[model samples]
Structures are given as structure tokens and as C-alpha cells.
Target: MPIAFDTTGWQQHDRATWFNPGNGDQVTLSYFDLVPDLPASLDDLPKLRHDLAVVVGEVGCLIEAHVVRLGDVPALLQVVKVPLPNQPSGQVFLGSFTVPKADSSAVLKLQAAERGMTGMREAVLVAQLGFENWVMPHPYAPEVQGRLPFHAGDDPRFDPQFADHPLSRLRAWAHHVVRTARVDPRFAALPPFRPATQPPAAQPPAAQAPAAQAPAPQAAADTGAADTSADVTGPTSPADFTAPPTPTPPADFTPPGESPAAPEPEPAAPEPSNPAAPPGPAVGSTLTTVVPGLPIGGYLPLWVGEQCTFWRMSDPEAVLDKLGLGALARTPLTDRRFRDLVALDASSATITLLDRYRAEDGSTGGSVVRLTRVSGQEAHQALTTDTLLDAFRRLGRISLAAAERGEHVTLEPGTHNGDLAEPYVLLAVEEHEGRPVATARTAPPPPPDTPMWQGTAAVTAPATRESVEAGGLLAMYAMNTWGEHPLRLCLTFGPR
Candidate 1:
């Protein structure tokens, strides 16, 4: 009788989900191990090898395997496939080996020799052997369904009503697994699960005009009784032309003392107080208050618009732990808002939170925050060369080098004039172990060169931190084959 092979146990151990073959009373394989010695009665080595290979294939690490004769001994050869550079139609060998029948442990002992191999090999082997029984899948795994009761409002898993549900116990198990699992180095090299794109620049709200001030009271000017002394001048005919003698003041009229009655000094008008600062929303918008234990009092600002201020947590990990924002950190900034707060541009404003004003209950004491735009110099001063270099390094997915010293590649020109649209250049070149394997470039292409001409190209200064922070490089490329081929390309280095 042939031995029946079942991989349900392996699947459950490695993936944490039992495979339902929809059969009743099927005996499931509980464990698989590379026995040190082959059974003397086991005559069909080829059949056993084939069965094991099939199991491995189900987990997607299958490359190729076959039994071959090594001298007088039977040996099994296995090849594990890996990603290659540059050519989508190509693949390079990541791991390849032969396991002799006399040495059953040889395959299990294999280790990767290169940077990319370490992670790839470990991932593959783990899938084949499965983790320990205690190991569980990621907490957020969608496959683990119905952990919570359907009708339990407010997540009854935490309440006494659903204390016995499987979900109630999942949290502690997840924490243990997450804390104890061996971290894969390849994860560090991987790009962010979702990258952030430049958000649309925010338009400033229109400013409101100041309220109208009451008009000041004016004093009446004193004029001597409207020239009563002057003779009423009617239309005087030339015949009546008699020059009126100048009226002399009465001899008895003494000059009034106090210099002819000095005009009463008009009460000095009160100067208006400096206009109150214009009322409007302050500059940088706060996303959420920093979790307790953080040094900063303000909230993390969203990455909105061109300028905004965000709290720089001294201990980000601690804050993230308290707020459960680790998963959110992996997502694109534009996809989620922190505490439902929108981001304000840092360049335009500063945000400060009044944490000391918390209410008696410890909730926010009604927002005592200030957001105000900064001066132009203050807004732009932070984007120094070092700042940009740090940002580029933090991106991890891309790299920047001096254009003059960087490697260049020539591509066949396409059929559109580069002038009409922005010149398209390779934004990034994916590499594996420092070797270029793929290329990602801007869309649209320039017109193809004439039969006799190649293409024109040029490169600007290397991308600075300022440029990248400003959203994208402003470099241009033009291709001409006539005299000298000018290949203007912006090279971005990325992971393979």
C-alpha cells in the first residue's frame, strides 16, 4: 500500500489556517521531518521525493527538483527561484543544491551567501518546515474570522459576556508572537507598503475685514459773527461806485486780554489702539494630541498642503505604542488622518497645543491651540542640504548621487516631442545587491531620432534635498542623435 501524504498540518502550522478538503474522517499529517536514516524497507525513494516536492510547490517556493544518480549513490537536486535584475523575462538562481541520500540533512543546512539570499532562503525554508505549533499568524490576518461575536456590541470580547470567545484570547497571543518572532532583515529593505504622493497645495482661506470703528466727535470751529461789519455788497452799479471808507474799530473797544481770546484748544482726539490681530484660523493644523509620555505637547500634524507643523515626538516608538499607530505609520500619509485632524503646511504655520489646560476628567480642556503662519525665511530655513539628504536617506526606496559621477544608460527615443511635455527621465533604477536590474521612469517620451541621428540628452545638478522635499526633481532631458547624443536623464536608485 502506498503512503498517503497530507499537508493540512503543515499549512495550519505555517499559515495558521486549517485547510478544509471537505472530506470526512481523513487522517491529517501531524508532522514532517528529515529523518537521519532512510528506512531500509523504503524502496521507492523517487516517489517520496516527488511527494515532498509537491508539498513544497503548494507554498510557492517550487523551482525544480529531480532525482539523479551521483556516482553510485542516488541524489536529489533542488533549485529555488529568485528575482533577477533588469530583464522581466529573466530570473537568476537564488539557491541551487544537491542532497545526497546518505546526507539527508544537507538540504536543511543550506544557507544563503548573498544579501538577498538570506531573507529569501529563510522565507522559503520556513514555509516548507512550518513554524512551531505555538506560532500564530499576524493579528490583522483576515483569514481568522468570527473571532468576535456578531451581536456583541462594543466589542464584547473585552466584556464578561464574551470573555470565553476565541477573540478575547487572541490579543495576548498576538502580542507574544509579535514580540518573539525572528525579524527578517529583508523587511528593512522593503519600501513602505504604501508611499505618499504629493498632496494638492492648500489654498489659504480669505481674510475677514476688521469691524468698522465708530467715527470720532469733531469740535465746531469759532468764527466771528459772519463779518457783520462788512457792508452788504449788492450788485454795485458803476455810477454808484463810491469806495466805502475802511471802518475803524471803536476807540472805546480795548484789545481783548489773553491775546484776542485764544481759541479753546480742541480736546485732543484719542488715538486708536493698534488694530487687533486679524481673526482667522492659525497656520499649522494639529492632527492629534501626542500620547502621554511624549515630550511634546502638540499633536502630530498631517502632511497636507505645502506647509504645516507637526509635533516631533522625542520617543516616537513609545507614543506609537500608546496610540496604536504602528500600522498607520506603514500606510501612506495621505490615506489616513491622525485623530481625524487635517494637516496644515509647516511652511505656512506653526502649531502649539496647550496640554496643561486639560479638563478635570483628563480630556482636552477645549482646544487651547495656536496656529500661525511664519515668515518666509522661517518657513524655508529648515530645508537645508543636510535636511534633504536625510529625507532621501529615510526614503530607503530611492537614492541620490552626484550626477557627474553616477552611471548613465541610453534608451531609444520615443515618438513625441520632449518640448510639449516635461522631459521624461528614469526616476529610479532598481538594484539587487548593488547591481542594477530594473528601471522606473517618468511617463511620455520624446520624438524618435532621425535615421542618421541618435538622441539628445543632458542632466542637471544632482537632486538636492530641497528639490525632493519640494515634491520632485526639476531636471529635464532631451535626446538628439545628429552630432552628439545628449541623453538627459535623472537617475533614481531604488531596491530591486
Candidate 2:
């Protein structure tokens, strides 16, 4: 007998989902952990480990019986497994339950029994990860009549519901969807909806237009003026407010292509913003100077057309808790409204958040973010390492997730964790002495000769900055790390 979640015993099955991309089948168990009912203490550690192995093994459920040290600590362990499937096999991928930080099958099943939806978190779009996406404790809903679970919806890209439906209509209604003919019966239909946390279904695409949209559409719009004629009872039309006058098309409306006179000459663009802007070097300012091998700050006014940036603050909440500056953090970001580039900076030592404003100004004044900078007189402080590492992890998880899905990636300083697509195929914060130590980063790897994919940088949100005299060295460290990658192939310092 074999453990239920353990892939070792199942007959290897070829899958159409896993073979589509050039990158062939490979198993990856993102999460495998025990949910101890007993206290995890040093005195009871050995007994806990043995009991886990015995009970799990008796049911053919243990992946491997092993214990790992947490630096000098002894209670924690990172188990090992002989591959069978990357994820536990089941009817449909119930993304909600099968992910990192969550407990193993026994734990999930217990929790699911207690809660109708499994109450599992961290579910993601494993589109590129394959049928491993479907691995679970049982083949989908264990109580269902069919073996597989049913999600409710069609692939919007291949279907028109996501596009043709009005924003108001889509949000108010649900998609009509059914299971694949081969799908198991117990599973009900799947919903075409994404996690409630993702950008709303009707979100307009980035680059849809420059920021500052003509305000969002309003409900109960103003109706056109009524006729006030024999059958009418409402106010007269605004057009009728004045006489029903018909203005001439133009003083000189000409027939098609009759050689209309040319318009007068147009004015030239204004001179460059900074007259003394750096010269000789092709890059902008020392801060704005972006060498192919340099960090983002090497360039100024981070652009949207090509270049990008990311940054963050120390503990943004600490400031709010101490000084009551929560309102400052809540202020919305505007400059990067077009959603092209992400800006990370600290308003003060206390609070930090990402600002999604326009990259370029569509009207007078700077980008919307400039107006919405996160600052309060009471919250003066610098950015910190948490902010920088957060930015890095965000880029790794999400920016790459898009790359994995062949979708676009957004690199912003303030984006949340678990929001990324999957640029970072693997990222873990190395722990020591039962505590998180340093972070480890790994990617699918770019081909040799083009190290462009590898970027390591340290950004000091304004909170990270102590003074102009110090000159945001923490940020410089991140930029330099990102720009300066070893020419050597295959990682020398990854996954440790």
C-alpha cells in the first residue's frame, strides 16, 4: 500500500495538459507539511515524528519518513518524497486546497469536513504547471457523485462571455458552463470566476488609455430632456433649451480630397526638462543612469515605454500603529494610472504601500502618484529590508507567473505577495534557528549569453533612506545586485 498523497505508487500517466509547452513533464510538490495535533516540542519531537511516519505509512500516505533540522532547532522537518506526481491526483484541480503553507491531505480533508469550501488559501492559476494542478487528497470533491470536481466557467480567452458582457452585467451574472465530457460525475459545474482577490473580471487592460479615465461610468445617468410636446411631460431638451438651431458644418466644407488649404505651422516641443541634465554619458542622471548592467535608479523619472522599477518601505504598518498614520497609507496612488510601471517609495519611516499611477503625465502637474505620495508629518521614517525583499519576492512570484502563462507581467514595488504570475519558479526564505534567515531565489533560467533574465537589486523605500549623505545605499545594493549577475551558467547560489 502507498500513502494517498504520495505519488510513488501510482502508475505513471501521460497527460495532454503537461505536454503542450516545450518544457515537458516534471513533478513539483509546492507544499508538503504535517499538521500536528500534538504540541511540536523538543521533548515530544521524536515521538511526533515516529507517530507521523507510522500512521501515515500504515495508510500508505507518507511521502517519506525524515526529519530536517532548523539550524540548531530540532522540532521542524522538511520531508522528502520519491516522485509519483508533482501534485496529488484527483478529478479537477481544486486550487484553493492544494498549495503552499496549507497542510497535507489528512489535514485538508479534516478541515474540508469542518468547512464546506475547505477554507484553503493561496490557490493560484497553475495553467502552466499542468495536471499537477489537479493533485488532491481525493479525486476532487470526495462526497460528490462523480470522481472530479466541477469549476464553473469557460476559458475566457477562448470564449466571448468575458469580453462581450458589459462590466455591470458580468459582475452581476455568472457564466453558463459545463464539465468536459470525460469529466467525472460527482463534480458539479465549475464557475468561470477567479479568486475574489484578483483584478475584477471587467478590469480594462493596461495601456487601454493613458490614466485619468473620464471618471468611471455612473448608475442612473441623466436622461436627455423630454419633448414637452402633446405626448411629453418632462423638461425640454437642452438642444431645445436654445432654439432648434442647426450650425453650419464649417465656413468652408469641401468635397472629398479637393485639395483643402494646409493648416498653419505647429509649435515645436519645449526644451529638455533639465538644461544641465547629465551630458557625455548616454544615460540620464547618476540616479537616472541606467546601464545595461546597472540598477533602475541609475535612470531618472522611470519610464513606461521600455524601462521599469520597484521599491517599498520598512514596516509600513508599524508607523500607523504607533502614530495613527493609517489614513496616509490609504491615500490612493495615481501617477502610474496607466498601469505600465510600478513605483516603490516610502512617504515616511512608518507606512509604505505601492502606488499605481500614470508613468507619464497626461495633463499639467506630475503623475498621479506624485500627488498621492504616502507621507504624513507624523510618519517620517526610512524604508527597510522587508520592503526590498517583499519587492523581490513579488517580482519573482507574479511577474514570472505571467511569463509562465505567456501573459504580461507587472513589476511594482507595492504589489502584494501571491499576486505574481510565476517569474520566480522557486523562491524560499531560508530559515535558521527556527526563524526565517535569508531569502533564496531561483528562476527557469535564461539561456547563456543573455543574462538579462537575472536581476538582483536592493531598493530602499524612502523609509529605507536615512539621509542624503547616506544616499540610499540599501537601494543601490539591490540595483547593483540585479545588474551584476555572474557570467557562469547553472546557479552557484540558488536553492540552498
Candidate 3:
């Protein structure tokens, strides 16, 4: 609505008003009239990339980002990739340019899904570059793991050879459009967006200095409020862990293959305290503030039903959502089969229970449903068996052969690992209408080397709607190891 460009050589679709090239590639032009804090200039692209990183962290990786111009107007361009679910070799690529003014912005996007192996070009390119293998280490910081490295077709190093690749095509088109595009006069005349700056807090008189001031800095450090730079590992302390924020286009979009300049480092934060207490959001309270961190699971709102209840934010809900309760919200929890059905592995008399809703209904939109163990003494009492808790418990045990295969196996509550460290259980809930409702709880940090997205490491803090809206929730993804594809699920919450 805010910009115009040629639509040559393209068709149209219901949702894609721009154009399609007959192939799977699509181009769309749209605008958000009011996107708070969207910068009007490209100077902020470096800072904005960190914010954009949070959104793209889940399900994809940013291949290239740049600050450029469109018809004399500053703009941002970006290229990203999202791996297709259940298709290890398939990928969805997006190339876009974002132009922002004041509190609004316009976006021009080109998207294409490639179903073939993504790195074929890399094999040849690697040999030409004198590399032994094409699988190079990712260029991001060490904390940013699990994301696949830049594929050859998307990687700029091979752009000369892969000129017909989606990313390359998009770049050529973006440059042409930027040179000829026209913006609505009214939109261009709007006041430019300015970043908000916080004033220093007023200090109390020396005669009345607060006695507890010493702990304030420690608290800030523990919550990871001291550093917003990229180098800070996600969730330095448990208090900072949160659900992944919803993905959104940032104010600036750059060309594929161009990396944003790293921002100046912030002062180092003080070391966080290693508290043995569990880490999670405060549930059932009206408190709006929570520490921001990576998303370990999906977000769910509190629910209250005649037969069941739910807490505002909890990792357990995310766990259940991944196991299929999320899609079955319309189904009555009172169903007996959902409450008590169990499968026995006769080979070892082991027990297993699949997410019957997913099994019987074939819904959930391809979300990976793996049996997540709800360990700890409190898990049993917090979750009611009549509400499908037991069914989820045995689902993990159905794969005892995984342990024999040397895969990491889910352990039951009260069980110890080879190192004898008890798995900390982070769960809590309340009961209403005689139905059990679980809430969030705290737990000690997982082992330093416990990779994210693996078993228990995937369970961090619960996210709430308010947290996401306030920019306290970061969208971070870990691989979903329990499935053939690397898929992650986002839990949602709402009142029924």
C-alpha cells in the first residue's frame, strides 16, 4: 500500500497480491501502517539485527542482511532459510527489502522453496576454494548452534556459479525495483522514527539511601539486563529464559550475503549467582515483568474449563503442546481413552503411550510429538493422571532401544544420570473446579555442556502474551531431536 513496482513476468495468488513466477517462487509487497519503534533510517540496522535475530532464530538462519536504498529511500534487505519439516534436504528461502518511516514500514518479499539437497553447489565450490569439505562451521557465535551453515546456493562465495539460485534472482530483482520504485507521497512525508532512550533513574538522598541497593545490580546481572549485545549467551541465568518471540520483519532489510557490522561490545555483566532453585515465569499473578531469554518451548495462555484448569505460563504446557494436547484443545479432556490408554512393550514389559489425539485425529499440522518425561517428585502430584499426564510419561520409555543404541534416553523422575546429578523438575500448578492446573516453577541450570534442544535442555522458561508484546520473549530454536526432521513447536495459551 505504501510502495509500487513492476509486476512483469508474474502471476497472482489469493494471499500473494504481488506476483508469482509460475515456479514455486513468489513476490509480495505489503506495509504495516503502525509498527512501533521501526526506524526510518538504515543507521540502526546493526542494532536492529539483534532484534531480528530473535525472530528468525527459530526454524531458520539469516544468510545475509544489508542496509541499502530503494528509490533514494534508505532500506534494509535480508535473506533467510527455513528448513522444510520432515524433509531434511528441503528449504524455504526468503529475500526481502524493508523500508521504514516513522512508526510504519513497507516490505517487498520474494520467497521460494527448494526441495533438493541444499549443499550440492557447496561441494564443488569448496573444492575450488581448496577446502577439503563443504560442511564449514557456521559463522555465528558459538552460543548460536544447531542452525545449519550457509548453503551453497544462498552463500555469496558461490554466487558467481549459482547465479540462477533463488537468492541470486531475488537480489537482481530487488536492485532493479529499488531503482524504479515509487512511494506514496503521504507515507514518505511522515515524521521519521526515532529510537527511545531511557533517562537515568532518580537517586534517593544520601540520608535515605536504601539498604538493599547492593543486590539490585546483582539482580540485573542475574536477569541478563546488563547486556543486549550479540555476544551474550542466551539466558545467562535461569531468570532470563523465556519463550521465543513471534517472528516479524525488522525495519531494515539488506541484500543477501552482506553481514551487518557487529555493534560495539557492552560492559561485561557481573557473574550470575548459581541458585539451586527452579527457573520459570511467575504464574497466576498479574505481574507483567519477566526476564527475557530463548524459547525452550511453545507459549500457552491460562485456561479454565469446567473439567480442567491451566496456569498462565509453564514449561509443562509447552511439553504437552509438543505432545499434541495443543491441537486437541477442542477435544474434551474427559475422554477416557485420552485419560488412560497405555501401550506395553512386551519385549521388556516397558510401557508406552502415544499422543492419541495426533494418532487418531491426524492433526497438529505436522508438529513433532515426542514423549517428554515429566520427572521430579512434584511432577506426579502437579499433573493429574486423568488429564493425560501419565500417557505422556510412558511415551518416552517406549523407546528403550534408543538407550541401547547409545542415544540419549529420557529418564524417569527420581532417577540419576551417570554422573548422579538428579534432573531438576520445573513444574507447578493449581486446582480449580476440582481439576488440576499446573503453573511454572524454577530449577537449577542444566549442565554447562547440555546442548540446547536436547532432552531436558529444551525445557527452559514459559512465555506469556504480555512478555512477548513487551519484547521480553526471544525467539530461539533448538533442534527437535525426537523426530526425523529438525522441527520445534510453539505452544500458545488462551482462556477457553
Candidate 1 lowest-lDDT run of ten: 250-259
Instruction: Give all TM-scores, in the order shown.
Output: 0.23, 0.18, 0.39
Candidate 1 lDDT over residue span 328-358, tens digit each: 1111222221111222233333322223334
The sequence of per-residue lDDT tens digits that candidate 2 reaches over residues 289-369 is 110101111111222224332222233232212111111111212322212222222232111122223236542221112
Name the better of 1 and 2 by TM-score: 1
Model 1 RMSD in angstroms: 43.5
| lDDT of each candidate versus the true structure | 0.25, 0.21, 0.37
Error of 2 at 63 (Å): 6.5
Q: After superposition on all CA atoms, what RMSD does each candidate show versus the true structure?
A: 43.5, 29.2, 24.3
The residue ranges of model 1 lying beyond 4 angstroms of the native Cα positions read: 1-53, 58-60, 81-109, 113-304, 308-442, 445-496
The lDDT, on a scale of 0 to 1, for candidate 1 is 0.25
Tell me the spans in candidate 3 whose CA falls farther than 4 Å from its real position. Answer: 14-16, 36-41, 116-119, 126-143, 151-153, 198-496
Looking at candidate 2, the ten consecutive residues that score lowest on lDDT are 105-114
Task: Count steric clashes of candidate 3.
Answer: 23
What lDDT does model 3 reach?
A: 0.37
Q: Model 2 reaches what TM-score against the true structure?
A: 0.18
